[model samples]
Every structure is written in structure tokens, then in C-alpha cells.
Target chain A: AQTVTQSQPEMSVQEAETVTLSCTYDTSESDYYLFWYKQPPSRQMILVIRQEAYKQQNATENRFSVNFQKAAKSFSLKISDSQLGDAAMYFCAYTPGGSQGNLIFGKGTKLSVKP
Target chain B: NAGVTQTPKFRILKIGQSMTLQCTQDMNHNYMYWYRQDPGMGLKLIYYSVGAGITDKGEVPNGYNVSRSTTEDFPLRLELAAPSQTSVYFCASSYRGSNTGELFFGEGSRLTVL
Candidate 1:
């Protein structure tokens, strides 16, 4: 069984600053996918970014990027120039290749942005 | 586009009451999943379906049931509600061939069992 862990239960970032949310997972599968999902107070889950284990290069999407260290089983999310809208609960998830889309998720990290 | 839609955005039920959570997707995805999110806890998979007429259990399937009658709809049923079942339920769908494993989630349905 694969499990994701988000050590930080809560995080705070100042507006226009950067914050990094840490995540780690335990999985034996060589081919897998890692994802970060954001849930706002509105309760809508939105995709933030994703990383493929086979790819050594990190994935970047606008202000959201991931520092994926496959050997360490660590996948951390970085938010650059954070805005108030970035305040939300972020979750790290995992899904092995050919698993048919079943995902294992971490507890979550609640982020708050100060103006 | 309305990616995924879950009905009865909010509902409260008495103990032992029976109800169903309706989920529908417009993306015609091949895989659909039901998950429950408790306070301070991440979502836990309740059930999943690969396609029409094929269902499977997930991490936490007890006290719940599901059916995939069509590629676009997957409904979850609670035969007897309990206080432990009080949580926000989410319905999600994804294309089987999506390499990134992205899932489109519906606006969750919040349920309370009193």
C-alpha cells in the first residue's frame, strides 16, 4: 500500500512571497505519478501540478512547481509570489502506473496568506 | 464545462436513515470514484468504478454501496446512516489514459448524520 505524508499541518505565507509545502510518500512502484490538489473555502478541489516519477526534471505550472526527488520519495510544492487566493488546503496524492486512476492522498496542509 | 456534478449539496439525516448521493459527469470519463473527507483528515476512497457495470471497493467501503449504471453516472448509497458517516463527500472522474492521473472533482456534497 502506498501512503502520502504532509508533515506540515498548517503554513502561513505573506502576500507576494514564496512558500514551500513538504510532502513525502512510501511506495515501491518504480512508475508512479504525484499530484498536488488545492481546496479553497468554497470546497472545490482543483489541480495544482503533477509530476511523473520517470521524469527527472521538476514540473512547473505558472506560480506552482514541484520539487520531486524520486530517490528520497519526496515531492514538495512551491508557490511563488503567493497571493491571497492561494490560501487553501493543499493535498499531495499518488497513483501508480496502470492502477486505473486510484489515488492515495496525504492528510493536507492548510495555507494562509497574509496581506 | 460542468466536469462533475454531485446532487444534494447539503443534507442532514437521522440515524439509520437511508439516502443516496447522486454523481454525474459530463466528460464521459472511464473511471469514477467516491471519497469522504472528514475534518482535519484528507479524503478517503469509498468506492470506484472502471466503467459501466463494473464496481470495486476502495480504502473505506463499509456502510456504503455504489453502482455505475452508465459511463457518466456513479451514485453512492448509504443503507443506514451513522454519526461516523458525517462528512463531505466528493465525486470525481478521470480518463483512463490520462498520463498525469488528473481527476476532475465535483463540488462536494456535505452530509450530516445526527
Candidate 2:
């Protein structure tokens, strides 16, 4: 069994600024995957980014990046130039390697982008 | 494209009532899943199916049933609904061995048990 933890229940960031949402997971598997998902007011779950534990180089998507610290079991999402559109409930998830298993998610952190 | 579709966008069920939440996908995805999201909690997996005729229980499967007779359709059944079961349900699908295993979700079905 694995568990994902998102300590921040809510976060506020000003437009054009940067914000980092922290996430931690307890996994005994050496190889796994980490993901960040966004659910806006519309309630649509959107994938933000993914990181593979084996890869030391963090994964990035445009202005979205992850600081994956494998040893410390931390994977935080960094959104550069935050916009109002980024306001949403963000979830951190974990899945094991080579398995089509269900994702284990944290409680979630609601992000608020200040105009 | 209708990636994932769920029926009964909103429903109010009385105690002990039963209903099935319909879900279907046109993307030909091999993996389908059912999840429930509470007021302030992360989505909890109810059930998952790998392909036609192959279904498995997930984190929280009590009080819910599901069937995958075909690859495209996966329906979740709530037997004897209770207030504890009131929540928003989501249907999601993804291609087997997806590059990043990203799930495409449906609009969601909000069920209220009173």
C-alpha cells in the first residue's frame, strides 16, 4: 500500500508570480510514478505533469515543472507565471512501476490565483 | 470527440433505493475506472476494469458494484443507497500502456442520497 500526502489545504498566489505545491509519498517500491492533477471549478480533472522515479531529471511542461527528490520522497509542482486559470484543486498521485494499478491520491490542495 | 461520457449528471436517491450510473468511452481505451469524490476529500477508487469482462475492486468498493461486459461500457451500481454514499462520481478511461498513463475523465455524476 502507498500513501500520498499534501500538507497544504489551500494556497494563494498572485498573477505572474510562481508557486510551489508540496507533495510527499510513502512507497517501498524503487520504481514508481508521480502525477499532479488539476480540478477547476468546472470539476474536470486535468493532468498537470508526471515524473518517473528512475529519472533523476525532473519532468517539465511549458511553465509547469516538478522538483522530484526521490531519496526524500518528495515531488513538488512549480507553476511559473501563475494565472487565474490556474486556480483549482490540485491533487498529488502515486502509481507503482509496470502495473496498471489505481492511482493513490492525497487529500488535495486548493490553489487560488490572485488577480 | 466524446472521450468519456457519464449519464445522470445529477440524481437524488432515497434511502434503500438502487440505481446504476452509466459510463461509456469512445477512445477504445482498455482501462476504465469509477471513483467517488466527497465534499473535501480526494477521489476514492470504487472499481476498475482492465478490459471487457475483467473488473477489480479498488480502495473503496463497499456498497458499490460494477460490470464490464464490453470494453466500451462500464456501469456502477449502488445498492441500497445511503446518505454516506452521497457524492460526485467520476468515470475515467485511459489507453493501456499510455505514454504517461493520463486518464480522460467524464463530466461527472453528482448523486445525493437523502
Candidate 3:
């Protein structure tokens, strides 16, 4: 069994600024996958980025990127040049490599962007 | 493309009431899953199916039941509704092959048990 933790329950950032959301997980498995999903007011869960445990390099998707520290078991998301649309609930998820793809998610962090 | 569709968008139930939350996907995905989201809790898997006629319990399945009759549909049922069961339900699907593949989620169905 694995669990993800999002320490921050809420966050805010100014328009065109940068903000980072922290995430940590507990897993004994060697091979796994980590993901970040964003849920806006519309309640649609959108995948922001993903990182494979085998890869040492972090993942980046445009304005969204991740700082994955494998040994420390930390995967943080950084949103740059933040926009109002970026204000939403961001979740961190974890899943083992060989399972049925059941994702264990963190409580989530509500991000607010001020213009 | 009607990726994953779940309905009704919102529902209110009383104790002892029974209802099924419908889910359907047109992407021909082989894997479908049911997840419930509480206020501050992210999503907890209730049930998932690898393929038609094959389903398994997930993290939170005590008060929920699911059936995967067709590859396109996986419906979740709540029996003897309890206030503890009130939450937003989301239906998701993914393709076969990679276990690390991405999941496509529906807009979600909000249910309130009184």
C-alpha cells in the first residue's frame, strides 16, 4: 500500500509569478509512477505531468514542471508565469508499476491566482 | 469524442435509498474505474475493472458495488445510503498495455446522502 501527502491545503500566487506545490509519498516498491493532476472549479481532473521512477530526470510540461527527488521521496510541482486559469485544486498521485493502475492521491492543494 | 460520461450530474438520496451512478466511455478503453472525492480528500478508488465481467474492489469499496457488463460501461451502485457516502463520484478509463498510462476522467457526479 502507498500514500501521497500534500502538505499545503491552500496556496496563492500573483499573475505571471511562480508557485510551487509540495508533495511527498511513502512507497516501498522500487518501480512506480508519480503524477500531478489539476482540478479546476469545473471539477475535471486534468493530468499535468508524470514521472517514471526509473528515470532520474524530472518531468516538464510547458509552464508546469516537477522536481522529483527519488531517494527523498519528494515530487513537487512548479507552475511558472501563473495565470488565473491555473487556480485550481492540484493533486499528487502514486501507483506501483505492475498493479492495475489504481492511483493513490494526496488530499490536494487549492491554488488561487491573483491578477 | 465522448471520452468518459457519468450521470446524473447531481443527486440527493435519503437513508436506505438505492441508486446506481451510470458511467460510459466511447474510447473503447479496456480499463474503467470508479473513484470518490471528499472535501479535502483527493480521489479514492472504489472499484475498477480490467475488462468486461472482471472487476475488483479498490481502496474504498465497503458501501459501493460495481459491474462491468460491457467494455463501454461500468456503473457504481450505492446501497443503504449513508451520510458518510456523500461525495463526488468520478468515472475514469485508460487503455490497455502500460500500467503507467494516463487516465481519462469524467466531469464527475455529485451525490449527497441525507
Q: Which pairs of residues collide in candidate 1?
A: none
What TM-score is obtained for chain B in each of the predicted models?
Answer: 0.96, 0.96, 0.96
DockQ score for candidate 3: 0.65
**Model 2 stretches astray by more than 4 angstroms:** B97-99
lDDT of 2 by residue, B41-108 (tens): 89888899888999989889999999999989999999999999999999999896323659999989
How far residue B76's Cα lies from its native spot in candidate 3, in Å, is 0.6
Residue A33: error of model 3 in Å?
Answer: 0.2
| lDDT, candidate 2, A71-103, per-residue tens | 999999999999999999999988888767478
In terms of docking quality, how is candidate 3 classified? medium
TM-score for each of the candidates? 0.97, 0.97, 0.97
lDDT of 1 by residue, A3-115 (tens): 99999999999999999999999999999999999999989889899898999999999999999999999999999999999999999999889777468889999999999
Determine which window of 10 residues in candidate 2 chain A has minimal summed lDDT: A96-105
Query: Once model 2 is optimally superposed onto the true structure by TM-score, how far is the C-alpha of residue B81 displaced, in angstroms?
Result: 0.6
